[model samples]
Target chain A: MSTTTEAPQVKETTKTVDFKTIIDIKDMDLYYGTYHALKKVNLTIPEKAVTAFIGPSGCGKSTLLRTLNRMNDMIPNTRIEGLVDIAGTDIYSNEVDVETLRKKVGMVFQQANPFPKSIYDNVAYGPRLHGIKNKAQLDEIVEQSLKQAALWNEVKDFLKRSAFSLSGGQQQRLCIARALAVNPEILLMDEATSALDPISTLKIEELTQELKNKYTIVMVTHNMHQAARISDQTVFFLNGEVVEFDQTDKLFSNPSDKRTEDYITGRFG
Target chain B: MNNLFQDANRQQISGRRRNDLIWRILFLGATLFGIVALSALIITIVTDGIARLNPDLFTNYPSRRASASGMKSAIVGSLYMLCLMAPISFVLGVGAAIYLEEYAPKNRFTRLIQLNISTLAGVPSIVYGILGLAIFVRTFGLERSLLSGALTMTLLVLPIIIVASQEAIRAVPRARRDASFALGATKWQTVSRSVLPSAISAIMTGVILALSRAIGETAPLIIIGAATYVAFLPESLFDTFTVMPIQIYNWIARPQEAFQDLAASGIIVLMIMLVIMNVAAIMLRNKYQKNI
Candidate 1:
């Protein structure tokens, strides 16, 4: 559940009681070619809540996040074991379409990669591929997605300009807008703010808090403060396995596991 | 003792510096040798051909009389061959590159195919001439027509186009493809919408360079039995043809002294056509580059 904030006290009060399990992972294991990338991991993600995955480098947080939408399928010789179900549907089942899964679970990457295209085209790319051809509808989606990412006021007049013309922070926000344009139910952020400056990183954390009301959000972060500030639930990972899963405040204040406590206190990674 | 060691080190340094100076002068001489040879060849060609450069070169067809002979049919025929070869090579070459770079699994078979393509680019044009003669010219019964010659040239330059295009496609960043795929795009959608657009300028540059090689090719056309004296323009794809190189070769072979100037003039025209083609390619590449 989200912690209390003065400005949104009423909204925060309402959000704490309405939580439902949306993603259920049971004994999930993943491998890349013959190397195990993720060990047996089990967790439940609540709908319309922000979850953060915090760990050291090479701890498999990003790998586990990618498996949520089957993005790991793109890698050659990658194998997954056990179940990862979203809304009661097993995503690893043969009948499950990876593309459709990805549409429902949008992802933003560590590096902000705006296609070498106009801003309008970058946002419209997802919808256009999903078969929306109407100019008016595309324009509406582009406008709404940009406004949601808090980038519309800066980019509205020059929609036709190339996306690369923007600064790094703007480009990362543009990537978020691009992911939102598809109307996904879940958003995955894989170190999305690690490439930005402190100010840009703060802006993204604020955005995550605002976005959690409408979408289930999972973020992988090296910055523990950002995770504590934004996420409602926190999962600590170590050596491809989860060390602890608890409410954000409890995990930060009184971690149940010694490793989690060490990591949180900067004793050792 | 320290002074003696220092003196030895300084002696070694001076010796190495002298060796470096010698190698630098030797390398400079080698480069100048090549440049001097090339400039001499250019000067000879220009002096020989400048007086004979006339409008008749574009208006009249080939003739036994050196004064009357012009490169009309040969110029038109080479252009026709280029027009036919460019599209065929671009589609097949770029498609194969995309498949190899984007879709093919990383296995032994793909590696072998890539190795063979690199090897094929090194194979002589004359060998391709033999292959064309055995296949398109005889087996398909197309004979020495424009279509047969174009097909042969396509095979000759196909390897170069494929290799260059593969390099271009491979140069595209992995991040772009990941971003596209993360947005629910299928494989082809990611390639065509994102990857291809970013690499198109490089692809165009490669294709144009390949097409230029195809335009100047003579061995394959000769082996395919393209007629040396086709007076009329090729009205159809099946019509017999002779490209610029073959025409210039014929002129150079003639015993008459005047024919040498005529050959030089043909060379000039051929070079001009190549320049024009390259310029057009650069313009197209620039337009696509701006979009990316």
Candidate 2:
């Protein structure tokens, strides 16, 4: 089979990859010092599906997304309460090694932050960190990842070129390729395309449709249309609380909560 | 409706413009003051030393007779002291910077340490000479050898390198660390592979500038007893030595008119080294700026 995963293979891969609840969160609360960032949050993310967290600014959407991979641990005085289980294990437990946890759950940021390195090196960085020293193995992983991220065709000739040479959109895809080279089961995107132009945002949206066939994707987006367009499930948050959660079409077409409806239909956010 | 194009307060507008020009001229004068002073100094040194720049000045050791005296030992001493001091200062300075910036908790203790480092960077160089006296010279019993002198120079430059390194490290975008950690890299791995590489050029630029300062330093070495009239080269780190600045100081202090000329020649050599280092720093930054 070609290294580039095609959309037609989604059904076959879903059966093998266990398209079930990969993430289980219950009564989760996050506090940045005295300020409560995420309160009484409960969410379950299934494997091999796209879940988008949508809300206005400072509504705890990004905070909730960060809790999945524990990236919020980087902040000072960030305290967490309640259970966050991923793949049937409490990620915040003392026994869980954060490095290994992050390897399984990759992340891409709002900015397309490629290292000041050659494109090939950026893609191979993750695998190298996990001790993949064999040159041939790294080459194959880099090739497959770049292909999967839809960046291989444009960059195949100059893998030696610095990643900064790529355009903003291409650099974002390179970051995705870097994330995928480690073979992560879950991918977290924190406003990953908010920095891009319309065309670039559309390209990332299309790439997400193709990516959910293999990896569980959790995204935080300010654009409600983006949630409706790409996500299988949509979550709407308001002021550190989850106001509504439903299937994408159902939530956009007919939200159960008045606040969600008001926010979605050009009402006060 | 009010007129859109014409301005009403003609006098006020011209008055504001005049103040702007006045400020600009004042700033220009301030800048020219620095430039004029530096050019005058350089011109004086070049004229005084240009004739003394012969091969013998670099080839022979100091002699009692002004005509025969050369700067071989002092020149070699400064170079060797730099070689010894550079690595020691680099590791200690950058290590402390990394620890403070990356790993240290934002507590009162770390804040105190940060304040101390800032204060040390401003302390008089002669004070560092006193520190070297009590610590390296007397307590350690290292004596006034090349090693002691090097250790003293390291102390003098450590604060500068550390502050510069810290600033460089802080300037590394938070995005770089986020990208690394999201890939499951450990703290050491992320710092070594991503953050350090991004900050390397800036840190190196700072380190080179600090070393240039250390090279021209005289008061500290004098207080630490760097030797004079040294006719022999050091065989090892523990041997007695004298640097160019010390040699030049002794030369200028002498009553003979000829020694002043030799001092000018020594200043020329020292200035050349500093210029080369600063240029190297700029080149290093330009080379790495494009990569990021």
Candidate 3:
């Protein structure tokens, strides 16, 4: 891993932390028009691990997540500086294709957004777009994705039913299945369980735990407990800057930064 | 409660109830007036046309003899014109709407174009007839024909369809497009596969309504020189034709009482055609709404 220089406190904190880095953000800054949304944010997300971004509202956690897949490029008058490297390749490089980058990095939104199609079609949508047309192959992929997302048994009998017929939690899982159908390497969930009931939230947390074994997962969450429960590394953000980044257990138990402790202790956010 | 407060409250409640009753009755009378007027019109038309309703109305061509007068050519002409106008306007209007809503940059130019379209929708139908006369008839040398008349109606209703379709396209939530994009679907695939399907029922409803208006229009057709009397149906796009409105107008102008009755019968047929078209539109909307 490349050494993250100074703030002597961060260096002292990282001495006990160890992981194989897969995504490295080096002195990154992002602006939406005149608004500086992220300011010299540096982070290293590890492979096959769940990294959680915990921050108050409007802290730019979601903005940083979107930048990973170049989704920020869709917004008008948005600009980025410095490097965002995924798997040792600079994603913002001129040669990178946004479509191919998105194909490798899947995202789930705060609200479940399933297409207004059949349950089977929802999972099969991504594969179909990439030119997978064989019926048997599509069927296999659909079943595998839904099963992987843990939505197959409930929906397998009625694959032709409209996706809207499913509950909100089921719809979110279907969206997960849809993303997985594309065979992405990294999964980004931006408060994916914030809209769900506690039971559904637990189910998704469990799914995320299972999914992290195969796919590198990064999630931005409002629930600190969720981050504590699922993440291997926890990054605390405040005011468009990273306040703390350490092992999840270490950060919660012995936070290095005062702001991180204050925010996490329900003192102020 | 204090006696004074109770008295005041009771007085206010009774006064408000009295005012509410008066307004309710007034609104009910207004609604009844429209329904009663419409029922009277239908009764009058049905009664007047009942004697003229026969197999001859559908089979025989218009003639000087009132007994032999029929709307065969007019019916065929209207249907053929509708077939041409519906598809043409739907394709053109929806295409323009999609471009404006999905692809066009939001700028002063786009706002100006949108304002122009809204203004165009409110322009007099006869103004479009005059335009058709200058462009399709004189400039293009098409003369007074079915093609010219259909083209005029198409222009007359095109603005309405475009405006309605733009609203429909705009109504599709951005999340659907985002989902499609995140899945690596190209812009075209996202539109055709998701956006269009979601907005289609509304677009079809708008197109069908515009076509209904086109079917009933007479001022533009007359301005474009559609035939008032045609014994034979239009054999080709270039052939002269007469619509039900034009045929009815011709009958109502004559001094003969029998011809006036025939006009009443023609009105009934036109109303039936409109009802059928609207029912089809409603059915299409409901069918697609279920899927969406």
lDDT for B277 (candidate 1): 80
* Residue pairs in collision within model 2: none
Q: Model 3's lDDT to the true fold?
A: 0.93
**Interface Cα RMSD, each model:** 0.8, 0.8, 0.9
Report, in order, each candidate's fnat: 0.79, 0.86, 0.74
lDDT of 3 by residue, A88-112 (tens): 8999998888888888999998999
Error of 2 at A58 (Å): 1.3
State the DockQ of every prediction.
0.78, 0.76, 0.70
RMSD of 2: 3.9
Error of 1 at B260 (Å): 0.4
TM-score of 3: 0.94
Candidate 3 wrong stretches, greater than 4 Å: A1-18, B1-8
Query: Which residue runs of candidate 2 sit more than 4 Å off their true CA positions?
Result: A1-19, B1-25
**Count of backbone collisions within predicted model 2:** 0
Runs of candidate 1 with Cα error greater than 4 angstroms are A1-14, B1-31
lDDT by residue (B1-292, candidate 1, tens digit) is 6666664677789999999999999999999999999889878998999888899988889998989999899999998998899899999999999999999998999999999999999999999999999999889999888999999999998999999999999999999998889889999999999999999999999999889988888888888899888789999999998989999999999999899999998898898888988998899889988877
